[model samples]
Target: MPVTKATDADFRQLLDQHEKVVVKYYADWCGNCRLFSPKFKRLSEAEPEVAFLDVNAESSPEARKLANVTNLPYFAVFRNGELLETLAASKEEAVVELISKLHAN
Candidate 1:
């Protein structure tokens, strides 16, 4: 699926509506986040069955607490509204593996 933007207001509710989701927390000024965006979008297109949600950390204050994101490009994989894992890095292989495992389950 195409990557969608979610804010603090509706991020959780959005995730609750999807069976499999990949939520990415990022900031505009972060180099790591900037570098990962294109790869993430490509992955979303490849894995159209999964919901990809992007959140701008600067604008979404509540996201920090909800996602517990300490790094520039934090990713959280969720299945049926429950968090499966948290990834602190911005790598394509790691994301692909997480989604594949979650979707398989």
Candidate 2:
């Protein structure tokens, strides 16, 4: 599945709609966030069953609060609209581990 760009307006709805969701919280000026974008997209394509979302942490206050996003390139996994875990990292391995948690359930 392709990563969907989400905002404060549609974040909640997307969460509610997908059973397994992985959100990548990023900021426009965060270089790491920009660098990890392609990896995130590739991960999304690999896991077709999961819903991947990209949200600007600086703009999406409501979504950012759900995961308590404190760093750039933060990743949060949600199952059935409930937050499971969050990781702040730029490494693809770390993001893969976070996404693995979704399948573990």
Candidate 3:
């Protein structure tokens, strides 16, 4: 699935609507965030069953708070609208591992 751009307005609704979600929290000026955008998109496409979201950490306070975002390019996985894991990394492997948690039983 394609990554959806989310904001404070619709973040909660998206979380509630999707059973497995992965959110990438980024800031416009963060270099690593910009660099990892394409990778995040590719990951989303690879995992069509998961809901991928892109949220600007600087702008989406509510969503940021949910994951306790403290760094750029932060990735959070949610299952059934509940947070399961969070990772702050620029590496695709790390993000992949974070996403894997959503399906782990």
Return the TM-score for each candidate structure.
0.91, 0.98, 0.98
| Candidate 3 positional error at 42, Å | 0.4
Q: Residue 97 CA error for candidate 3 (Å)? A: 0.7
Q: Give the TM-score (vs. native) of candidate 2.
A: 0.98
The candidate, 1 or 3, that scores higher on TM-score is 3
Order of candidate numbers by lDDT, starting with the best: 2, 3, 1
Candidate 2 residue lDDT tens string, 1-105: 999999999999999999999999999999999999999999999999999999999989999999999888899999999999999999999999999999994
Q: Which candidate is the best by lDDT?
A: 2
* Candidate 3 clashing pairs, residues 3+ apart or interchain: none
Regions of model 1 farther than 4 Å from truth: none
Q: Where is the poorest 10-residue window by lDDT in model 3?
A: 94-103
Q: Compute the lDDT of residue 12 as modeled in candidate 2.
A: 95
Q: Which regions of candidate 2 are displaced past 4 Å?
A: none
Total clashes for model 1 = 1
lDDT of 1 by residue, 71-90 (tens): 87988888887888888887
